[model samples]
Target: MQKTNELSNLTKWLDQFPLFHSGDEVDEVRQKVGHIFVPHNLNVIGQEQHLSADMNHLNLENTSVNTLKYGAGVKITCDPFEKFLLIMLPMTGVMDAEVENGRVKACNDVAALINTSDPLSMNWGEHCNQLIIRVNKSLIERTCETLLGHPIKEDVKFASALDMSKGHNIYQSVIHMLATNPFLAESAKLYPLITKQLEHLLASSLLLNQQNQYTQKLLNPEKIITPLYIKKAEEYMNEKASEAITLQDVANNVGISLKTLHNGFQKYRNDTPKNYLKNLRLELVRKDLIAAKLEKSNTTVTEIALRWGFIHLSHFSESYFNKFGEYPSATLKN
Candidate 1:
């Protein structure tokens, strides 16, 4: 008899990897599943039924893609995940999940995101099968920081539901390709570089697509290119900080209009170019003062301040005190 083809890309992908585990014993299946995911309680919900569990796990450098199913109706409970986030995409049937925020009925074209810190319980129908993507918690946070161009002051949290039923979803497409394509499997093994890049692509997709703490900042068109523009402006300012360069000069050198430069800095950095340059010069002056103190040099504060473009001693001293809580002389003195 000819074998029937599987309809889900996830099933095709799972065929490439060796079967991680498969059995009917509930305890054995639970232990094997827990080893791949997290420790959890799994029980058959129907009377006179036993588990018909099948699992295939594919581990990449920073993420894992998996497919799992229990051929009998089952209930599962898991404590809050501490180290990874799970995206559960159902390929067939339905899985109802109770997450921290609310309940989600995940099925074809609708998915559930298990946030790293949310407690979870799920009920899988006897025929339900799912493609689960497990991403390292730190990787997602780091990607958020990278996209924002700053450290995240708070733990990043994503909304628990993802609607893939509409529009082009790069994340969903990539995951689906990963599940069904044999080229990626071979490429992942043959090229470490491609593996890392693929991991980043996966993280970026979910972050940019799903609602999250950083989504507004990440998706804002005005803020999107601001980080790059601001960074270049800062670089130009730092190079010409001690020179008699104007904000217009900095803007011209950085290839942005003066007004744009000003608006970008004000909106993102909360300071104008003039103030930022002044602060930068003030820092340079303080560094010299500290160096002079350490070396016991006879260099006076006036001479060092002048070299850094600060013409007025009194004004410079006041700004220095405001920034460092001490006068320039105090910084230079024992």
Candidate 2:
């Protein structure tokens, strides 16, 4: 039923006060939340005493959503949105979220990264306090292109599940954003530099970490790589080998485009940027393994290798043997 009494402050309404109305009120809520997100159709699933939402913008580029709702449940649906990528991270309760064919069981540690072009729906549990982020779509796409050194042929897609487990840079970035709750809670606005830096950081982290259509090429550039872009890309890589980075990131940091970067690596190094970076990390890891062994310490291959993004232990071992003429373990012992 349409209730005209709902507060117009949907983005800032705290649920603590005795206020929430009906379907129409919730619709108005959706409209107010638009400053930070796209409008969505919300259906209240059960009778509830309090259903409230509050949002704070880091800037036009990012918005943080704080919501508390109680009832049997609620569903929020959206078709393709012209802007913003929706990322929902539950802090108190679980939310069942789906985007196209991918489903995410969102909890305190897991989040749902949604691409707005795909139809999305979320079912929130009776008691849920969730934090949501609406990231600017154009900013992300542009960053992706800069990293790729080329235009994207398909929509930028993100893996449905955002695992907050250790080593996932995206998860760490999200946590860093949340840690800035003081600024969000202090005022409805933020300094341009503060917010813009945060938005750019999130965009960069996701493009580098999230598994998407461009992941393989970004991670392991091949067949097309050449020498023109090689020296610059290699210098960039050598400068930041310890950090989590992709070929696209290197391409972006270097003043070259992805195609030109590929040409440079091929022409000079006769190797793909990805391959060179991988070997560099492997060599670094071997050096550490040997030093650890010499010290008679507790260092192990698995622990040392994972730190360098080497997940496939067998493959790493094989490559280590090929490059050094001995297994990693042997290298460590010697």
Candidate 3:
């Protein structure tokens, strides 16, 4: 059957489920599936829901599953021991996910792998659509163990998110495989391929998470200030001096406390963060001034300074002389 047709059929089945019509009864249904008590409404149409013989296994009818409506928003509270991973591919709109520590915004073409055991909330905006798959944790772990040729750690969670662009491609491929090769879905022989893809997706997410985390650390001081963190912060300051920025903004981005950030920068650069940022701004202004000297030939010192976040002309002039051994006007004259 065509993928759309299959999904449509699945959606039909889900709509027929008693839980869909029973307003608050969906909570009971979810709780029975090992989720903690929470009030949320599910408006599913078509064959969006499916279950295998095993209670833990489920095949989300991708075709018939059109809109997975979350009445009070996409706030799903999971039981700690549920041991299920939810793979969600948002077809349209964006999803804002809030966890204990942080939040991330996920949009179309991206896949979010939510650990149902974790206390997290998802906010799905209007016009949003998605394909959701619920997989048993044991099944995934066993698949990973067999693929890696060893026992995988149970506690180490894969990235709870995946890049939509890459995920969309993978989702399409999976759907194609499942639709064209029904036997593969039935026999569980496709576990190897699934495992490999899952591993790759998780790895990608981890790398992205680390990169973002590292970036946040670099921009904030309360976080660890490694050499790389300092380097990245310096680079970012240099690149974004023209934009409206502040030390607090930098610190927040780096995920560090303000005091710790100052100390780290002082230790590494031997200068205060404000002073360092000022110098960077001055450097960019200097470059612009030098270029203007050749091009416009009449760009004033105040013009260049103000253009680069130097609000006070006297301070700008003093800093300019200290760094380059010449006042702004002197540079223009030379």
Candidate 4:
């Protein structure tokens, strides 16, 4: 499913990872590189005249993760991501990087934690292929608040470093999902049901293990994300998804705070309430398209989309594609 007009600006094809080939165009390559991950100037190194940048990426709001390959030697420079944080590692090839205060040796045995709001730089070795996870700064910070059961007056800043050898299990879980499973496990993108689970789980893991101001609080097992509360929230959203219901509205209806609602969903569904509602709306819209097609009705894509509260046509279409791997009109074609 390709991104519809509404979602094309910020999403990839529903089932595609949005691959790109730079054809030695450094500036052009940098733009795509910058758009999905962060702004960076990529320069080919030492006799590497024919530099080609290949990349495949996805945007999970809080987790805009991707894999990039610059077919030869190159160096990348960038400022901190304004509102995001990054977790980067090499899936293949060696990288000698100095980010913030940590130095990844030539052996490339460790991952780099980057504060997108802090200045950072790195150099990529020839033949290096890397996996970069870019997550929204606010989302991670909010997760801390949920864990601690209180509002945070200060922004959460993670340590500028991580030793991958220490949290091997969590890192391995992320890698396994990226390499195989319902998320990036196969050639096609998983639907929202699975995609959200993977993203929430992996993103949560990053906040949980990576050294941060809220590490101890997040690690506490005492927080009660009552499953009953989660179900109540889910039920309310499922019933009102087509009625312009926001996360707050659902949270209120469920007798829980918005933050607690988020925590509950994260614990039980491995998803955020907003995403879970969006998923339901997407599924309903798809169903309507299929029904209209079967009945040979006069319904248009806009009608069906709007009925489901997807007023932003292009984003809705892209989101539809993101879930169904095809456009709504295609599904309803006469």
Candidate 5:
């Protein structure tokens, strides 16, 4: 009953958005949805009934959120999703899927993460309505590389089942925010900074939270003894924190490979070098914001953030909130 009510509420919440696709015709609905996602074999099953399908989609730069329902039982099969990863959360009824990991019946508490290049199939219950998050393949790979401080040769493979009961509600919250937030509605047009950060957030969240090929390595990055050169690298980073520097630049200055620099930071600082530099810049931004607040200065957050090498305001604001438990504007105000 509780799950049903929650799904009902979510359905209502999603209905506020204009429909992106809907129809009672099988071929038309299938083709429309295929264009939005990918071409797939969508077949009606069990009954010879007129099709009833509807979809609501929101597209971002590197990620998209979609709510889909085929008001009749349907079986869908497709080749590997070669370009993106799909996270499927069934809002009502069951969705049985066969992916690389194995077969799983996704329902209220169970979600699906599909990323492998293996052919897969799914059977959606007649009343099934699902919320799907599509993230770009290259985005995930790039985020993984940033975390490992090196390029990955193989694709990131995620376990098919996502146990949403175990604190995975963050995805829904983010989706809800995207759907309802007025600023976000116009973010892509007027707030590229926000979209960039949101892109990073989604990519990072998937890599950090989902069970993937790099899970163990990411959790326990090889703990080597911190070397003197690692300390020197930190010093170099501190001195150059205000400059637009890349991981390669830091490694080059320390006369070490990116992998070696990552190992040192992981072992000694319990973080990736990329994050270390970000936190350093965030601290500088906060300090400056606090001073501005005290002096009643008219300097904008954008100016201070850009001065400290943060190009994306939304990303900077999100990072500021994560670090200080408040937005940069709040810091500037109070």
Candidate 6:
């Protein structure tokens, strides 16, 4: 049906759909489709309406479809659900989808899909338009298997929305076929093609997910430890332990944001940036103490600690004792 003439009809149809009206009902739907409902605009009359549909064959107990109409600056809220995958295609304008801690911007030529099995809220605005497909967990899993060589892990939170990139032309072809060919409503031959396209799209998304994981690993290696910055910071700490060193110094030397550095270290080392540096200095002191013992040489605990950035003799002694369960002098004797 023409988008304009079908707007009201589609709205009426959505109102009657099993999962559109109530929050509880939406939740049940999400368990099957993996998402909750949000409001959208359907203004495609004289001008082309940006047509987007959310479809879930598994969630609908077969197939369920929802249509949206949104304008500039308009807002809508969809109830959260567990295990939802939403595929959105915008026909016109641009759309920005925000979910939980992540966001994606999409234009007419692109489509975005976001997958989440946890409760989430989304906001779209500013000339945003879209088509959404909500697929069930099992169906998506199966589809992923067909597209990817291996199965998708259950815990992975797929994007709630994805913008088509390399697969844009393929996606557009599917959209055109769905929009113009009424025969698609009945022809069985189209099923294989549709499934194939879905597989391609899902595979592309899987790659994107892997890339995002790698990026996050690079950005946040562990507990404020980044691979790129850790070596630099460690070298600086070793050289300047006797001198005062601050997080800002390390961040500036490495040319990264303090927060980024902190997060990177946290991910890589499982410790705070400052703590890791301090531990490194303490390790140097311990090595020196042990080396003196091996050489049958004498080195004062105070001298070793101070050389390694421990300014307060007593405090250094306490920290050293706590770490190694012995006084620094004991280590020198060992």
TM-score of 6: 0.37
Greater-lDDT candidate between 4 and 6: 4
- Predicted model with the maximum lDDT: 1
**Overall lDDT per candidate, in order of appearance:** 0.79, 0.65, 0.51, 0.65, 0.77, 0.50
Model 4, range 65-104, lDDT digits (tens) per residue?
Answer: 5767777788777777766777666656667666665665
Instruction: For candidate 2, write residues 233-265 as lDDT tens digits.
Output: 777888788889987899898866788777766
What CA RMSD would candidate 4 show? 10.3
lDDT of 6 by residue, 99-188 (tens): 665666655544455554433334445344344555444444444433432333343455444434445334344433333333433443
lDDT by residue for model 3 (23-62), tens: 2344444554333223344333234232110111223211
Mark the regions of model 5 whose C-alpha exceeds 4 Å error after superposition. Answer: 1-8, 11-22, 166-183, 223-334
Q: Model 4 — TM-score against the truth?
A: 0.57
Error of 6 at 249 (Å): 66
Name the candidate that leads on TM-score: 1
TM-score of each: 0.64, 0.54, 0.38, 0.57, 0.64, 0.37
Estimate candidate 5's alpha-carbon lDDT, on a 0 to 1 scale. 0.77
Candidate 2 positional error at 53, Å: 4.2
